[model samples]
Target: MTTLPTQLQHDLQALAGEGGYRDATERDVTEMRGRYRGGSTLVLRPKTTEIAAAIVSRCAEAQLPIIPIGGATGLVAGHIASENQTGVLLSTERLVNIREINSTDRQLVAEAGVILANVQAAATAKDLLFPLSLAAEGSCTIGGNLSTNAGGVQVLRYGNTRDLVLGVEAIMPNGEILNGLSPLRKNNTGYDIKNLLIGAEGTLGLITAASLKLYPSIKDSCTALCPVASPAAALALLSQLQHELGEFISAFELISGQGLHFLREHFPQLPQAISPPPEWSVVLELGSSAENELKKLAESALTKAIQKDLILDAVISQSETQRQQIWSLREHIPLANKKVGAIVSFDISLPLSKLALFIKTAVPKVQDFDGNLRINCFGHVGDGNLHFNVFPPIDKLACNYRSQQTEIRSAVYDLVQKMGGSFSAEHGVGRDKVSELLQYGDPTKLEVMASIKKALDPNGIFNPGAVIDPRK
Candidate 1:
């Protein structure tokens, strides 16, 4: 619980001006998906890192909990605040700025509030690539990406958000600014503090800015939509294709027939590249910086795959427009499903070898709760991460099956644990999964995590109830 000092609030308002703060309504503290609800006394949108630091210092003195928010697009409910606390919703929207773009170093220094798409566009303007991408790139902020250590389409090749970040400048709970923005590729002087804050989900600190690594813009590329017999076949094709294409393989997404069905029903605008969907579909992309015979190589590799019966059918994107269109279908599935109603979304990772079995075992357990339950499994199969989503059944009686959430989650998470996988993969263990994490995570690991939390945030003033309980 937190109690705000009226004098401190007035001082902060004076420093940031009248427009910098707002009294957070009940609506402001609730999550975007409405799965998690919270309340806060005020929402502060500081325009600069100094202001943020000052706000943090004031809150620390007052012992108030500060919940940092970006675009609020996270699946883990990481941005929610508690009602008992005088929760200060610290937003970085005003801090959005592309501070510098060094073409020579192929690096961009950006404020945390900059949208992921804007950063990509900035890199593109410099003939460089910021390859971290997802459906929420337009809305999800760079800070949120760093906080979650986001993994998206290009995780197979470019790696997760943690890989792209070269340095981070964050404000620790004690109001000390940890400045580590070095664009140098090699730094072995000491411990890597940047990584600690990268996926801490605002528990350790509030990320203000980052120096991000960039890649040479891909000049040649090929995309294909293929129909496969099953997830196993898709994995096999991925392995064979990767062995042949090597580093050229950028994105390989596996989509189930039911996932495709949702896209077709909700998003009629997207073109279906393959007819009469097989049990599974794959959207694969290959890219290269220097111009090469990419199309020929892709076609030949795909031809070999088809001949081997690894792929049932395939459609290659002839042009850039076609590639984007194919990607739209893959990206729009989540948004399309949201229009209908709520969903229990799981972002889990299993070993590539065990993905097929994990999906097979989990689907039946979910269906046993409601036979007509809509299970849409799709994600970066190359990275062994899948977005396993369960939508409510069409039948009203069937839709009222909330009681099965625990059983279904346990079944899926248990399989993930058995396979040496993470129940919370790309998504951090926010309040929503704290209990599950306590149950599944190693006790020793949790102890170390708690020790670190105590070391950095002794007062527990930063994003309470996130990642781990400070009170514990």
Candidate 2:
């Protein structure tokens, strides 16, 4: 199954030529979650979109699957192809280019392979901001971010990756280039194909380049880590802060006591904002164009919340160093989770009104399912997205609890469904979540999606097992 007919590899190599062909590396064949392993296949790194289109065209003629491997930083198993699947792994890493930065128009264009942090740096160079951010920004590429329509810390204010994209230029299933990277905000001439590809997770097409929207750089900001008695108390404080700070509130994260414990156990020397971490706390950040204005507003809001008995203790950042220290606690929680290991992790979102209720009901239920399990509940609370991960007791290993993963997921996901929440939030439904998507996904919507897949990929040559399986 790993064989690509020898001649096909040679043909692909000739098509890619010289610098385009690269030997398979350990990282390329493995996914982030350790769920899927890629098969031995030709890895083609096209330097230009034309070469990419030609490669796709060649694959289409032979009715071969094409997997567009973006940054390999995807949480879900989207990029990895199994042994039975035969095709070329097309990489856009060599397609790194900051095509244009229109300062006057407040937009930038970049190829798919550029790392997200590099794009942010380019925008910063122009005195602008690209608000899409995630923990893996340093490694994840812009194409991967757009493919998943990733939501990060600033989603509470700037919206998800799709909202930040003006347009995208992609290669359709037939290897034809769809030039939709328009700088204009308003264009209603045809079908909204740009959107279809944005969150399609590369099932419909391979996104090559994008025109992105940018925001004005913030000159000042205020950050604070305050303890809340419970999720409900955090919700109350969130409302009060929104009323006081309005759109300036950039990020609002909920941190759990166990997360702090994990950090202390692993990274004891790391600077922490709250010592002997409270049972529940929230990190709130506000950004503005004005100089030294948001701090007083944040202070006034925190004071009112404390008086109202919503906040237990407030520690506002005094300097830029202090601000980073406070954020360090929030940013490193996932790394800590990785070290401690999780039995099962859920990336879910609920209605703002149901956030508190869902957490209150879920904690006991999950713990009751496995008495020894510990929960780490936190995420971008302002946007209603939560990364609720379950871990084993200090002495227990996650592998030992593998038998209960199904039950644990059912316990949490069923409740999420009842609350009208999503089982998959920021992370797109990759190979890992296909079953859940079918179980929880709407039937009518699924049918339409299947039809779309069939229409675009008539030969079923574009990512055979991704997003939607080949329609009958």
Error of 2 at 42 (Å): 2.2
Q: If candidate 2 were superposed on the true structure by all CA atoms, what would the RMSD be?
A: 1.2
lDDT of candidate 2 vs native?
Answer: 0.88
Q: What is the lDDT of residue 165 in candidate 1?
A: 93
TM-score for every candidate vs. truth? Answer: 0.96, 0.98
Q: Which portions of model 2 show Cα errors greater than 4 Å?
A: 470-472
lDDT of 2 at 368: 92
Screening candidate 2 with a backbone cut-off below 3 angstroms (N, C-alpha, C), the clashing residue pairs are none
Model 1 TM: 0.96
lDDT of 1 by residue, 1-472 (tens): 3656778778777756657887776546677666777776677898889888988888888787889999888877788876675767888888899999998888899999999999999999999999999999999999999999999899999999999999999999998898988788889989899999999999998999999999999999999999988899999999999899999999999888877777777887778777665569899999999997889998999999999999987889999899998898889877866765544778899989899998888898888877888888988888999889888876553247678777788888887898899888788888889988888989999899999998998888888888896557
Candidate 1, residue 413: Cα displacement in angstroms equals 0.9
**Global fold similarity of model 2 (TM-score):** 0.98
Candidate 2 per-residue C-alpha lDDT over 67-137 given as tens digits, one digit per residue, 9 for 90 to 100: 88888988778887767877778889998999999988789999999999999999999889998888889
Candidate lDDT scores, in order, read 0.86, 0.88
lDDT of 1 at 429: 86
